[model samples]
Target: MGKDNVTVLCNCATDEMVKDEALMDIVTTRKVIEFMEELCEREGYPKEVLTDNGAQFKSKEMEKYLSERSIDHKRVLKGKWEEEAWKERKGKCDDEAWKERKGKCEEEAWKERKGNCEEEAWKKRKGKCEEEAWKKRKGKCEEEAWKERKGKCDDEAWKERKGKCEEEAWKERKGNCEEEAWKKRKGKCEEEAWKERKGKCDDEAWKERKGKCDDEALKERKGNCEEEAWKERKGKCDDEAWKERKGKCDEEAWKERKGKCDEEAWKERKGKCK
Candidate 1:
């Protein structure tokens, strides 16, 4: 019997007696195979095996094992056990025998009833059985209803959460993309501005250098022109002074020669008169 009060009965068909039994929290195909193997080893392999159409019994592994052992496998139809049992009982007993047994049971029941105590007991048992059956049916119905309602709630919650998550993800992605694009644009603009400024600075520096060079060249040319003019003026002054000195020396020599010629002429005249 399972925790849910579901019972599984495993037995052989020959004597309808349980040879071996196992209580498991969860029964699986592997466990079933092992159980059957142990049973076979103890009782020897049977010629045939009969079972219901359970997943563990009808599985490929079970079928293969049975086939390898040359065991004929049979499956009884589900929900027909009661009918089969009735048929078997009918085959074993005739109608006259059933009527005889029924009459004997009635007579015994009437004799056993002393002071309505057995009837009261029977009524109590019947009431208890009906109550248990009703409770079982109610529990099954409530469980199924709860499962259906829970399934719908879970689905709705999942869909709502999924939609919210997707929306958030899309927003985040969009924001990141926009931020990246803006950064790229700003970076390119700044880079272009920097390049333009650098080029302008280079041009300004070159112009300043050229202006200084031109000023130095002009100063050098002015210095050379002044030195050449000073040299020409000194040469002309020296030539004028040399010409004045030569003219004065020539005048003095001419005067001395004339005085000597006059003296010699006077001495010759005086000696002739004496």
Candidate 2:
């Protein structure tokens, strides 16, 4: 790919490269920011980012975006990118050669060192090593067996303890439940008894009050009827006595006037005869 279209990100510590071919379409400050964001989200944000002084990387917006996230942005000096690239290639080559030399040297040194001591030590220590190995194997087996037995004992003890605890807990819960039930039943029975006694008392009091009220009402009604009847009889008797006195007075006045007229006529007849 052309250098103009390709963008490369490298880890300074690992010398690992991440090349973005997507920048071939169009590279702008916005696109650069978006790629950085996506990269950071996928991997992680870098402490420092070194890029060549391209317009997209040098823009104020790009600087602001990097600064806001606390990422240090470094612009490569003129010709520094190419120089660094050359140095990196040369360093890699030198490192590979050095590693090859070092590996050969280490292998030769180890072979010489081992050749001097390994055979004699092996001959001398073979029996000792076997004895030590046997002891270690025996110890390991015994340890495993002891651990197994201890584990079984611990498990059985734990089960027994757990069962006892559960039984005690169950018995406590049952006792508590029974006590609560008994208290509730007793309270309910007492409440019902009180209610029944109260109801009977209330009924008896109501009946007595009702009977007294009925008697008072009947007496009041009877007294009122007797008073009205007495008043009616007294009024009728007064009216009959007044009417009889008026009739007798009128008859006596008429008889007195008739007797005076007859006496005057008899005096006139005696005068005529003379």
Q: TM per model?
A: 0.33, 0.32
lDDT of 1 by residue, 1-274 (tens): 1222211224333223233333554556787778777666766777776566678887899889889988787766897655554554475466658778888888777777643776788889899999999999899899889999988899898899988999999899899898888899988998999889978988897898788788877777777777777767766776776666666666666666666666666667666768
What's the residue-level lDDT of 45 in candidate 1?
A: 71
lDDT (C-alpha, whole model) for all candidates: 0.70, 0.75
Model 1 pairs whose backbones collide: none
Candidate 2 — number of clashing residue pairs? Answer: 0
Q: Cα lDDT for residue 171, model 1?
A: 90
Worst 10 residues of 1 by lDDT: 1-10
Q: Give candidate 1's TM-score.
A: 0.33
| Candidate 2 residue lDDT tens string, 1-274 | 1212223443231243324633346667887787777767766777777777778878899889979987777766786777766666687789999999999999999898898679778876997899899999999999999999999999999999999999999999999999999999998999999899889988988898888888888888887887787777777777777677667766666676766677777778777878
Candidate 1 — which residues are off by over 4 angstroms?
A: 1-119, 201-274
The regions of model 2 sitting more than 4 angstroms off are 1-19, 22-24, 38-43, 96-121, 126-274
Q: CA shift at 244, candidate 1, in angstroms?
A: 36
